[model samples]
Target: MSGYLADKNICCGCGACENVCPTKAIAMGYDDEGFLYPSLEQTKCVDCRACERVCPVKLDANKGYPDYLKTYAGYSTKKEVMEHCTSGGFATELSQLILQKGGVVFGVRYAKDYIKAEYVCVTQEEDLKALMSSKYVQSEKKDVYQAVKKTLLTNKTVLFIGCPCDVSALKLFLGKEYENLFTCELVCMGVTSYKIAEEYKEYTEKKNKAKLTFINARSKKNGWFVPHLEERFDNGKTKLTTLFGSYYGYGFQVYNRPSCFQCRYCDKNGVADFRVGDFWGIKETDEFWNPNGVSCIFVRTERGLALLKEIEERGFKLFKTDYEKATVNNMSSLHNKAEKYVVLREKFARIYKEEGLVRACKKTESFSVKLKRMLPKGMRAFAKKIYHKLHDKKTR
Candidate 1:
């Protein structure tokens, strides 16, 4: 019964173990927090240790960070592509480049219902639109890793884009390096569950009496500095809620998988060829600063550097930038600190199960939060500042 659960709080739910299980013994099941964990079928288990071998958490423990290369702050010159993307449109540009070269590009996209995200391999340039923007929830890898291996074995170029853990798991599952495979990882903040996303959708649907057709979690509609959780309903009504004002956004930090807080991949050294994320905290005076959005790309391997050069040659805009200066305030790349609200998180989970998503959110709001909701827009800001100041002083 060699399970991958080295500890209660260690699984990243990358699905590498499930894909590698030779006898189909490992199944993914959700915990109270709605995050996935591997559940073994003891009767079917052959104890071959395939699951253990492919576990990224187990393999990455002793692995050192890869050598650093160069960093850049840039965006795509294509206006339409830049408009649809969450950041500088580097990912779309890169994916397009791979497709142009007859390579398969694997990326995360919302399922038909817009409630869950899953990895899909795109071979045509038209399908690249599905891979654009950001999906804040944790994605289901399913058997995509196996599919990727098959493509790699066929001697085809493969580009895989995912969170840091997912990329690491794919590398571990392949068990060896393949020159044809190029991996890119996001500088993740953390990931919530599919259940959480589904529940939130259900709540939104019930409130609006309409089906959810589209959601841009990092929408550029209100500009990138303060992105909105923009949702379009089947009834032709659209709702745009600021990230700070949304329950799902607030809960994302507090109710993520336990492994996320103790992440082994949130460092300058990384296992992927390229790391991509929003160039947060950029100043207007900086040369690369764009009011729209900009991406800070970190090239970690020689292969990544060459591919980046090739993309630039194809009319993609890229600018050299300092890695340390770019990422100094970028918590997504450097910090793995979890939200400090264990009891509140547990309470919210219980309330969510007993009541529903909307009620649970309302119940979890602090006194100050509730008060802000009742106040006017101007008063709300002032109230929030005072509350935070008092709370910080009290904590100190």
Candidate 2:
């Protein structure tokens, strides 16, 4: 049988193959694209093929989306949480519940270098802030599967939040379900490489003449509808710019891992106990909708439902909704498919490698966007308004 991890096109870089290798022969190493893939040392090979058995992609075909026990559109009642979180603060609240029970939370956060995102364990409420928002970049998961297993064996409750692939990887590594373990899969569209984030950091610093101290991929300071990237500099300066204006944000769809376009775990097909994402399609006028933010939650297992019940008791507001309504504007909440732009993405990757992110933007950005860039600052906003009006009419 062909090695699943050997095929770069299919590997989600979840590190399960490496983690599951019995001889420690397989290790995760980056490709030219800066995405991780399992590499084997033939000398240490035991030919055990443990990696193959644990591969999520290999096992994905037979497991379709199971019937969900309950679905809801909800938000945390806490005002402070709503202000800081990406969506309805469900993730934060849920993590708090686990921590309150003396359990540990596993989630993503930026490295001290601020160039890479890595999965880390948070045991205290004060440390939860680092893991509160989305990073958008693929996170490094070195040895975390082992750490999670160690914690679970202690009979403590654990909450693991990650992209579908990572959650699957962890579960497959354990090879058995722990009653105390709660897995929440973030609804993912795609994840870009950390290399892009590194380049964008340099680009931003060069443009602003200040080193970045922090970065938030999706900041809701302008409110939920108009999200912006927030950057803080060592010079004590702060900047909030539209996603389109940022190279990393604009190229997010363009620079995702190759496996993302052909993702097998999209929609409700994953192994997570529950799923969470922003409630996109619900209109502001809808009663379930919250102007601050709302999260679409899918509770699959009874354990997941029970957890939600406890959270509700602690002030979470949940309004029951069907899968159809919850995913109308946010199909990615249940389905993950990228728009057709394979050739453009390829071209962008080439330009990005040769000339850097700024040049890639100039070459790959849509003509309408390029035209807007050429317009004066005042007219650009006016043009944006007119375009949105026409777009809203057509979509209606």
C-alpha local distance difference test of each model: 0.81, 0.82
Q: Provide the global lDDT of candidate 1 against the true structure.
A: 0.81
In terms of TM-score, which candidate is strongest?
2
What clash count does candidate 2 reach?
A: 1
Residue 263 displacement (Å), model 2: 0.7
Off by over 4 Å in 2: 1-6, 334-339, 368-396
Where does model 1 exceed 4 Å of error?
A: 338-344, 365-396
TM-score, structure 1 vs. true: 0.89
When summed lDDT is taken over every stretch of 10 residues in candidate 2, the lowest stretch is 372-381
Residue-level lDDT tens digits of model 2 in 161-279: 99988998898889998888999998888888888888989988988899999988777775665456889999999987765556778777678888887777766777888888888
Cα shift from native, residue 223, model 1 (Å): 1.4
Clashing pairs in 1: none
